[model samples]
Target: MSSLRETVPWQEEPDDGTDGPVVPSRDGAAEDIRLFDGAMDPAREEGLLAGLELLGADAARGAQLDFELLRGWQQHVLHTPQPSAFRNLPAFAKKGRERYGIAPDTRARLDACLAESSTAGGRSLPLAARAARACLDVCFFHPFEDGNARSAFLTLLFVLAREGVALNDVGLLRRITFQATDPQDALILARYFDAHLAETRRGAACPGS
Candidate 1:
C-alpha cells in the first residue's frame, strides 16, 4: 500500500449517498493548501485564509472539545453561507494510492470520543499521545463533507492548547499527511510534537525555522 505522503493530488468524490457528479468546488484540498501557505495572515486574507483568522479567535477562547466546538471550528474554516454539514450518511477519503472507508455512525462515535477524552480520566494519557489520538480520530472519522484535513489539524491545535502546549516549528506538522491506520505514524507524530515543543522552549531556530 502506498503511503498517504506519497500520494499525488488525491481526489475526493461525491460519496454521501448523493446523486450527483462530484463537482470541482473551488474549496478542495489543493485550494486549501494554497491558502494556508500563501495567505497565512488570516487577518490580511479573505475566503478560507480570512476564515482561518476567525478560527484563531475562537481558539483564543479556550480548548474545550465537543461536537459543537468542532462544528464551530468548521464554520470558521468554511464560511459558506450554509457550509456543508456533517455527513448524513458516510464519507470516504483517497490518501495516496489507498482509500479509507468511514463508518456510517461516525458522527455519534466522534461525539462520544470527544466527550470522554475531555474529562480527567482522559488527561492521564501522555500529552503527545493525546494530541496524536485526537488528530487521527478526526482523520479516520471524516466528519465534514469537505475540509477534513483542515479540521483534523485544528483538532490537534485545540488538544495542545488545552494542555498549554504550543509549537513555533510547525513545519513538520503542517506539511505532511499521515496514514489513518498506521500505528507507527502515531508515534512519529508524537515525536514531531516533542521536537517542535522542545525547539519552542529552547528558543532555537533551524535556519529557515
Candidate 2:
C-alpha cells in the first residue's frame, strides 16, 4: 500500500524565468499532471492519524513547536520531490530544507504563526483567514522539504480545531486535493479551507445565537 505522501502527484516544472513566482497547477489539474496509484492504505492512514495525535499532544502540552520542528517532522513525512514518473517527496523535502534557511528569524516567523492560531484566538473570519493565509505564506516561504503544503494544511487544521472551529469532514480536504484548479491550486485550496472554516463557525453559532 502506497503512502498518501507517495500516492499524491507533484508538479515539477522549472520556473519559467519570470519575474514573479511560479505557481503550481491549481486544484485537480495538478493531479492530472502528476499521477499516482493506490487507495488510501489503512496502515498509512493510521500512521498519519498517529502523527496528528502527536501534534495534538504537543499543542496540549503548550510546547512551542517551531519551524525547525516542523522541518524535521516534514522531512520524516515526505521524500524529496524529483522529476520522475512518481513524485519524489524527498526532493521536495530537500528543497524546503534548502530554501527555509537555518536562521533564527525563520524560526521566529513560524513561532508567530503558531502563536496567532493558538493564543490570540481572534474572530472566526480573521482567524480562519489568517490560518489559511499562513499556510500559503509558509509554503511560499518554502519552509520545509517536500511536504510543506501538506504540513501547512495539517498545521492550519490544528490551529482551527484548537480555536474551537469545527472543520469540514476529512472528505472535504480529500476532495480539495482532487479538485484544485491549475496553476494556483494551492491558493484555491487555501480559499476552500478558509471558507469551510467560516461555514463551520456559522453552523455552530446559528443554534446558540
User: Which prediction has the highest TM-score against the true structure?
Assistant: 1
User: Candidate 2: lDDT of 41?
Assistant: 47
The total number of steric clashes, by the backbone 3 Å criterion, in model 1 comes to: 0
Whole-model lDDT, candidate 1? Answer: 0.57
TM-score (C-alpha) between model 2 and the true structure: 0.49
Provide the overall lDDT of each model, using Cα atoms, as 2-decimal numbers. Answer: 0.57, 0.43
Cα miss at 135, model 2 (Å)? 1.7
Per-residue error for 90 in candidate 1, Å, reads: 3.0
Compared with the true structure, what per-residue lDDT tens digits does model 1 show for residues 52-123? 444455556754676567777677566666645777655566734444445556567777666543537633
Q: Highest lDDT: which candidate?
A: 1
- Across 35-56, the per-residue lDDT of candidate 2 in tens digits comes to 3111344434443444455556
Model 2, position 152, has a per-residue lDDT of 64
Candidate 1, after superposition: displacement of residue 6 in Å?
Answer: 26
